[model samples]
Target: MRINQPQLIDSTLREGEQTPSVAFTDQDKHKIIQGLCRIGVDEIELGIASPLNTYLPNLVKEAKKITAGSCRLSLWCRCKAEDIAFAATCFPDLLALSIPVSDPHIQERLGKDRDWISKTLTASLQQAWAAGIPAVSVGMEDASRADTDFLVATAKIAQQHGATRIRLADTVGICSPARMTRLVQTMKEAVSLPVAVHCHNDFGMATANSIAALEAGADSLDATVLGLGERAGNCRLEEVIGYLALVLGEQRYHPEFLPELCQLVAESAGRDIAENHPLVGSAIFTCESGLHQHGLTVNPDMYEPYAPERVGGTRRLRFGEKTGARAIQLQLHKAGLRLDEMQIKDLVHRIRSGGQVLNQEQLLRFAAKCC
Candidate 1:
């Protein structure tokens, strides 16, 4: 069954900050929070709560004031008493306690066994609840590599411990969509709490995996603007939301705010938006291929998946080395100029030889000379 309305927990402030050399100042964080609120995200992960990160408490306070309960605010914490204590001070609506369930992380990184993880997780949850935190989500770090039975057992523990949600993380970005589908399905079947998925893009399938999870009845998905995170980043907020709104007819998200939201995050992250980046890219709507251009002129739906305006973009047809006669004639006619078959063919040849893309006005100017 398709999840018509999946909750989006935007992690731009949390996971996005993990990107190397990226930091959001107080003002930047507030602006981004407001931007995310305007886009109607169900929740916003403010950032991690740590003693060394001294600004989190005040940031969460200000974010709460800015959002005023319109959106739920969450904080990421390790499955440690200290982290849970620090997170409680922030007074976020939810605390996401990240625990490594994979053997490599549990046995090698922490040098502990499954018993230690359960003890640590149980203690952390008890600590958060004792501090009067409203909700908690158990994030299973590296769950993609964890044994399915162990994952289910861990999820059961989380549910028993009063976690409001269970988040499965593809920590290494290695989970395929098919595997992701089965994993989410299994987790959902095993637990009564809401299931969320967090995917990385190391293998470039984060968005696909997220979609598969949603298809398998995931209640929520995590994403960051521009997919900014460690080592290739997380699932992109724009790509997932775009797919939901445009493909599955999920209407809770507003695609129009994506361009501005992504631009804001990009600027703050000191990164440039790729021209061909999906959904929010500046040049995605610009087409130059002869066949595509001709098809667009004939019927835009033939080549375009959806209208450019759907995502606050404009469509542009440009002529270059691949320009065809029919496309050239159509563009010329639209400009109130009629070029015969021979003239159109000659113009196409000149455009092809020049090897530069020409807009409608430039093509008109070239056509005047050719005729």
Candidate 2:
């Protein structure tokens, strides 16, 4: 199947702040926005446009300056006339008005019915338009669990109400890739408006589901840096962009900017980037297993999906207890040192007995001393 090149909407400034104990200062937000723009994302969701968030207007202004109109800036708001009215004051390029479409959220949470959902959504879109908002999107919260028929109906209503886009959110991260594909396909067939997917990572399928949605013809995907958000967080910006650029061969995004961008977000969130984190981790391209090291020594492509430099990473081999004799010989040969088989075997035993991982320089020094 031909993969669609989808627009990326990075929501780090908005959804990422929902992470516990995370509050990005103005400087942090500006830096993140600049970083995101450098990566060439299509849009950025700044934050909620509530009156309490007094910095939103200025944030939007600064984002405009940073992006210089190359990227669109958006503000999120609830499905209320007041929220739409306030969000218009921020002068964002787009306003995303969100409401629940599932039975649980509509009936139990909001104490309302589907009819009220349609009414409120219609009113919200109209209000945003009346307030002179240039573009508007309607988000269906808990859409993964919503009835398929009702979801189609709601999307049609959103389209009829002049929404430029419709966002389907996996509110609790219950969707598998197959489910997300079906949902996006159905919505695409039902509405002419652009379809966007927002997936959560409670089940660790946000990135998978998001890719599935794009393959099924979603027009956009929502993501956050480092996957920072409530609970298990949202789809990771780096993971999605990396797959698009490296695997799908999409040239619109720059995955090489991910390392620095993710580092900035991790520091602001007071979170540590796991060494094995896909795409931008410090050690993702580092090898320790003896078998893998041998493959890398022969042809890095045998073990690596792509060159580490594709994402601004470097390939590194570490020697340890797991290192095989052939890998040690290969490393020693690269350093212009040769040893007899017996000597190499004895050195391997000693290194394994030591039970420590050694870098290239350390392994070379150790081999010189022992051999």
Listed in order, each prediction's TM-score against the native is 0.97, 0.97
Question: Following a full C-alpha superposition, what root-mean-square deviation does model 2 have from the true structure?
Answer: 1.1
By TM-score, the best candidate is 2
Model 1 residue 195 CA deviation in Å: 0.5
Model 1 lDDT per residue over 1-371, tens place: 46757999999998999999999888899999999988889999988888878899999889989999998999998987777888887888999999999999999999999989888889888999999999999999999999888889999999998999999999999999999999999998999999999999999999999989999999999999999999989999999888888888778788888999999999998999999999889999998888888889889999888899988999988889877888888888888998777777778889999968898888888889887
**Cand. 1 Cα-lDDT:** 0.90
Q: Which 10 consecutive residues of model 1 have the lowest summed lDDT?
A: 339-348
Error in Å for residue 119 of model 1:
1.6
| Candidate 1 lDDT for residue 249 | 79
Give the per-residue Cα lDDT of candidate 2 at 200: 99
